[model samples]
Target chain A: MSTSQAPLIPAPGDTRRRPLVVMRSVSKMFSSGTLALSDMSLTVEGGEFVSLLGPSGCGKSTALRIIAGLGDVSTGTIDWPSSRINSKGLPEGDISFVFQEPTLMPWQTVFGNVYLPLKLRGVSKSAAREEIMNTLATVGLADFADAYPRELSGGMKMRVSIARALVTKPKLLLMDEPFAALDEITRQKLNDDVLRLWRETGITVIFVTHSVFESAYLSNRIVVMKARPGRVHADFPLKTSMSRDAHYRTSEDYRQACEKVSNMLIDAIGGEEH
Target chain B: MSDHASAFVPPKTGFFARNRDTLLRTLIPICVVIFLVLLWQFIITVNSIPQYILPGPLAVANSLYNDWGTLSPALWVTTQITMQALALALIGGVGIAIFLVQSKWIETAFYPITVILQVTPIVAIAPLILIYAPTTQVALLICAFLVAFFPILSNMVQGLKSVDHNLLNLYDLYGASRWQTLLYLKLPSSLPYFMTGLRIGGGLALIAAVVAEFAAGSAGAGSGLAFRLLESQYRLNIPRLFAALVLLSLLGVVIFAITSFISWFFLHRWHESSLKREN
Candidate 1:
C-alpha cells in the first residue's frame, strides 16, 4: 500500500558442496586515496563460521560489506559459484547483514523492523506476519513485537536486529562486530545464541571482529588480517571445543586456542605483510 | 497493523499528581489573566474612562454578543481565506521541496527565488498582488500562500536531506526502489520537521491574510476580520475593534493547537520529542 515490495536481498544460492563465495585478490581503495584492502583472497565454504580477525582499519568490516554488495571492491571480483548474487533487483535466498550497530529503524515497531526484509522483497505486512513472528519468537522477542526500537534495551535491540536478518531466511549471513558494543555477559549470551542459530539455520556466516577471545570462541576457522593496507596474514583451522557451553569457555583447550589466536593476531599486527 | 498491540501507554498516576505540571502551567496563566483583567477594569471604573476611549473586558464581551451578526460573517470570511491559503501553501511548499531535493541542480536554481520571496516583506508586495488578482480574496490568499510557502519548503528540504546515510544504505542493500526508500524511510524521518514548518506556517498564513486584507482595502460584504477591525478603528468603535482582535487571536490559538496535536499524534510513538516518560 505504501510502495511496492522491495526485493529484500539478492540470494544466489548453490546446492553443491563447493565454496559458496571466492574473493581472489580483492582490493579496496577509498576516494581519498586510502587503501583499505590489498589483494586479500579468501574462500568461504557454505555453512561455515569464519571469523575475519583484524584491528581497526584492517578492512575486515569493509570485506564483509563488499560481500554483502554494500561496498565496491577496487580490484578483483567476488565469485558466488552456485548463485550469482548481483547488485540488482532479483529474488533469491537473500544475503543478510548485521552491522556493528543494531541498525533497526527506530520509527518501526519490532515487528515492523523484522518485516523490513520481506517488505522490501514485495511481501506485504499481513503476508509476512507469520515469518516475522516466528523469527521474533526465535530471538525471544515475541512479546516485544509491538514495542518501538527506542523502548528496547541494548541486547534486546541487537536481538531484534538478528531477528530482522534471520526473517529473510538468507543462505548467507554477514555480521560486522555485531556484539562489540554490549557488556561481556550479554556478549557471551548472544554469542551462544548466534552459534545456536547458525547450527539451526545451516547458513554461511562470515563474522568480522577484532577480539581474539571472541574469534577463538566463535569460529572453527579464523582468517587473521593486518592493518596499514589490510591483507590476510594467515588462515588457520582450530579444534572446536564441541559445544559453546560455559564449561567450554572455561576449558584448558579453549584457553590454549585463545592464546594461539592472540599470538597470531599479535604477529599480524606487528609483522609486515609482503 | 500490530500497532495497537504495542499501544502500551504508561499507567496514569493520580489526577492531581499526574497533571501537577500541566495544572500549574494552565493555572498560573489563567490567574495572571484574571488579575490583569480585574486591574484594568478597576482602573477604568476609577478613572471613569468612556467605552469609546478604552472599552473594558465586559464592554468588549458585550460588543462580541451584540455585534455577532456583523462580526461572525466577517470572521468566517477571514477564516476561509486563511485556511484556503494555508492549504495551498502546504501543497505548494511540500511539492516544491520534493522536486528540489530530487536534484541538487534544481534546488540551486530555484531555492534562491524562494529566499527572495521570503526576505521581501509581504506588506510591500500585497498591494501589487491586489492590483494583479481578479478579486481581493484571491490577492489575500496569494499573499498568505507566499508567506507560508518558504518555511515548509526549507524545513522539508532539510528534513529530506538529513536522513541517516547508513539507513539509506540499509534500504539500498535490500534492493529497495527509490520510491520505496523515500516512502518507508525518508518520509517518516521528515515528518517531525514538516510539523515544525506547519506550526510556523499556520501563524504566518493568518498574519499574511490579515495584512493582505488591510492592503486590499476592500469594504462591505466579503470583508474579513482585519477589514472589520480597520472599519471599527476608522469609526472609533473601540469595543468592536477589540472584539474582532479577540476572535483573530482565538483563531491563531486554535491553529497552533491543531498543529501541535498533529505533531504529537504522528511522533508520540517513537520520537524523542513526543515520547512520554516518567521524567
Candidate 2:
C-alpha cells in the first residue's frame, strides 16, 4: 500500500476510444417520489469493462435499467451513437441484461432457458442449437443442457443466465449485481468467468456491484456513484496490464487498486452524511 | 458445476423400497373398502333385516348383475352428458379467460357476469333452461357446463395474471410481440394452475350431470341412473336402487381417477405439487 509501490496506471483523464453509448444529464424519478438518479452522465467505449461501484441505495441499478431500455429516463437522453436501433426505437438485440437474480423460467430446461432470447425473435430451436451449445460450453455448463432450473445449484443457474445473455452476441452487456446472492467462492469463480468472457468476446460491459474488490479486479474502468439522488462521484480507469488471475489477486498492484477504490467509496458515502 | 450433481443423484434402492409409498396408497384404500362392505353385510344378517327394508351387499351385487341390461344404456347417457359438458367447459372457460385478460376494461366488464353465473345454483336455473332449450338433453348439458365452467375460468385468469414481473420485462427487452409473449411465456406458466382447474371441474361435471337428471325426472329408456333410483323407490325394488347407487359412486371414483392421472401427466416433470418427495 506504500506510494513507492503504486501501480503505474493511466490517470482518469483518458478518453481516446469511440463511445458506444452516451448518457447526458440523465435523471430518473420513480412514481413513489424517489429520485433514484440525478444528472448522471457516462460514456462507455465498445470493448471496455466498466463497473458502477456504489452502495445499496445508489442508483447504479437505475442507470443500468435506463441503458437497457427497461426503465424510462425522467429528464435526459441516452444515445446509442454507434449501434443500430430496432423498430422499437431501442437497441434490440444489440444489448443484453443480467439481473441480480437468475430470473430464469423455472419450467424450462437449461437449453430452453438459454434459447429464450433467440426464440423470442422467431429463431427456430434447431437453427440456434449450435450457438446455444457453444455459449453453454463457454460457461462450463455444456453437460447440463437438459437439466431443469430446479435441479441446478444457484451458481449453475447463474451460469445459464449468463449463457442466455451472451447467446445473442450483443455489443453491450448490462449486469445488475448478478453475483450478489452467490456465496464467496461461487462469486469469485463467476467473476473470473465473466472477465474471461468479456475479454474473448470484446463486448462492452457495464457491471453494477457494491464490492470494491470485485470492481478493482474485473474492470478496466470504475465509475464510483453516490446515493440520495445518485450521481457519479468519480470516474477513473484501472489500467493494470497484469493478467487477472490468482497471481494478480495476490499482487501488490491489485491490493493498491482495491485500497484506492475503497477509500473513494468510503469518501463518497461519508460525503452523503453532510 | 462438476461436483454439485454428485450430491443430487438419488441413491439406489430395492423395488419395494422405491414403490413403498405408492403400494401403501393403493393397498390401504382397498382394505378399508373391503372392511366396510363386510361390516355392512354383518349388520344386515345379525339384525335379520328384510330385503325390502335393507338389501345385503350380495343382494345388491346380484341385482347389479341381473339389471346390467337395463342400467347400461342409462349409464351411457349420463357418461355422454358429463363428457360433452366437460369438453365444452374447457374450451369456453379458457377462451373467455383469454379474452378477459387482454385488457383491464374487458375484464372489469365481463368478469362479474362469470361470477354471477357461478353463484347461482344450477338446480335453481335448470327448470328455466329446460323450458327454454330444444330438448331435455340440451337442458342437462347446459346445467353441467354452467357448474364446471367457473373454476376453469377463475383459475386460468389467475394463472395468466400471475406471470413473473421479471420474466415479463425480459420478454419486453427481447422485443417479443403480444402473441409471442402469451404463447411462449404466459400459457406455459399457467399449465399447473390449469391442471388443478381441470381436476376440480371433472368431478363437478359428473355431479351436475347426475343432479340435473334428478331435477328433470323425465323417465323413459333413455333416463339416467338418477331416474332409475326414483323408479326403484316407487316400485319398492330396494336391491336395484342400491345397485344404481353403487354404480353412481363408482362412476364418481372413476372420474376422479382419470382427472388425477391427467393432472399428474402434465405437471409431474416440473411442478412442486406433483414431484416426488426425497423420502
Candidate 3:
C-alpha cells in the first residue's frame, strides 16, 4: 500500500523553539529497594510525539509519573521548561497526564470533567466555556457535555479524558497506555484521533504503551525499554513518511515499522527471561 | 402438513409462565398472613373470649376509629420523636464516620466505644439517662440517637475506606486536595452504603424511641404513645391497646418506606438495589 502523506501544513504554534521537558539520568527505587527505573534520560522538544514501549513492569509508567511530578525520582532531577520566566529563569505551566483508565470523576458531567484542571487553576466555568467546548468538539464529543462518565462507552469516556488533558493546553502531555483497554478497531481509530490532536495542538506527548504497533504508528521516535531495573533498550525512528492519517496503517513502511518494534520487544522480553 | 403446522406453532406458556415459581414463592407469606388473621377472629368468636384477653381484628379496628381523635395525637408525638432522632443520628453518625476515616488513632480509640454503645441495652441505661439528662425528652432522644448512630457510622466508615485504590491514586496523580477527594470521590462512592445504613437506622431509631418511652414514660410533657399504652392496659381498654400497637407498627412501616424511597431516588439510575428486571 502506498503511504498517503498528510499535507505538511505549518503548525500554528512553533513548539520546536523551546525545550518543553528534560529528564536528567533519573532513577526510581521503591522503599523495598526494588529499582523501577535506573539512570533514564530523555528530552522532549515541544510538539514532538514520542512513545515509551516496553513489556509489563517496565518503568514506562514510572517515567511518565516522574515527568508529571506524581512520582519522585530517587536519584535524579527533571527540569521542565516553565512557560513563565521568573527572575531566576524557572519554567512553569509545563505538564498534564492521561491515566490508563479515564479516571474521570464519576459524579461529574463530561463538560465538568474536562473543565477540572482549569477550575483547579482558578478559571471559572463561564470564563473557560469557549475553550472547553472547542476541546470537546475537537474530540468529537460536543453533544455529550451533560452526560456522566457512567453513561459513556469506553471509547467515548477515553475521548473525554483526552479532551480534559488537552483543555489545559500544557506544553507536555504524558499518557500511560490510555487506550490499552479498548478493542483493536477502537484503539486504532483513537490513535488516529490522538495523532491528529497532537499535530493540530502542537503539544509534546510522551505516550507509554505495551503495543508495538501502537508505539510505531503514533510516535515520530519510539524509545523501547527493558524491565527489572528498567533501562532504555533501543531507540527507533520511523522511516515511513506517512503522517497521522488512516492510510498510514495500510502502508508497507508502516507494517515494517510495526514489525521492527515487535522484534525489539521480543528481544527485550527474552532478555528478561534470562 | 401436520409436521409443518407443529413447526409454525408457538409454545402455549409465555414469559409469565417461567416466573410462576417466583409468583408462588411471593404468595406464600401473604396467604399465611390472611390465614392467621382469619384463625384469630375464629378463635375469639368460638371461645367467646373476653375483650381484655384477646380483642379481635374488627374490635381493634373499631377502637382505632372511635379513639382516633385521642390516638392520632399520641401517634404524632411518637412520629415526631422518631423523625427528630433519626435526623440527629444521621448528622452525628456521618460526621463521626468522616472523622474516623481521617484519623487512624481516632478510629482505633473510639470505634470500640461505638460498639459498646451499640450492644449496651437501652433498657438497662434508660433510667440512668432519665435521671442525669435534665429532661425526659432529651434522654429519650439521646437513647434513640445512640441506637441509630452506630450502624450508620460503622457502615459509612467502611464505605469511605473501601473506595477504589486505583481511583484514589488517580486523584493523587492529579494533585487533588484531600477536601476535593472527599467531596468528589469518597462521599459519592460511600453513598449507597450510607443509604443502606440509613434504612436500617430509620427502623432502629423508631424502635429505640418507643422502647425508651416505654422504659421512661412522659416527664413534664403530658404523654406519648407508650403512656397511652400503659393507660389503656390499666383501664382494661383492650381495643385501645390494640389500636396503639397498630399505630406503632404503622409508624415503623412508614419510616421504612421513607428511607427506602430516598435510597431509590438517589441510586435507582446507577445502582443495583433499585434495578427492575423485565423478564
Fraction of native contacts under 8 Å reproduced by each candidate: 0.68, 0.55, 0.19
Supply the DockQ value of model 1.
0.55
Q: Sort every candidate by DockQ, greatest first.
A: 2, 1, 3
lDDT of 3 by residue, A113-201 (tens): 89887876678889999999999999999999998787889999999999988887877788999999999899988998988887777
Residue range B1-279, candidate 1, lDDT tens digits = 686877787777889988999999999999999999999999999999999999999999999999999999998998999899889988999889988999899999999999999999999998888889998888889999999888998999999999888678778778888899889998888988999999999999999889888888988998999999999999999999999999999999999999899989988889989966767
lDDT of each: 0.87, 0.90, 0.84
Is candidate 1 or 2 superior in DockQ?
A: 2
| DockQ of each model vs. true complex | 0.55, 0.59, 0.28
DockQ of 2: 0.59
Better of 2 and 3 by lDDT: 2
Better of 2 and 3 by TM-score: 2
Predicted structure with the largest lDDT when compared to the true one: 2
Segments of candidate 2 deviating more than 4 angstroms: A1-16, B1-24
Task: Name the runs in model 3 displaced over 4 angstroms.
Answer: A1-17, A84-93, B1-43, B166-170, B217-221, B234-236, B276-279
Chain B TM-score of all predictions, in order?
Answer: 0.91, 0.91, 0.86
lDDT of 3 by residue, B1-279 (tens): 566776665755887787888988989988998899899999999999999988999899999999998888888888888889899999999999999888899889989988998999999999999999987878888999999988899889998998877568656655667998898789988998999899999999989988999899673244568878888998999989999999999899888988999999888766656667659
TM-score of each: 0.91, 0.92, 0.86
Q: If both were scored by DockQ, which would come out higher, candidate 1 or candidate 3?
A: 1
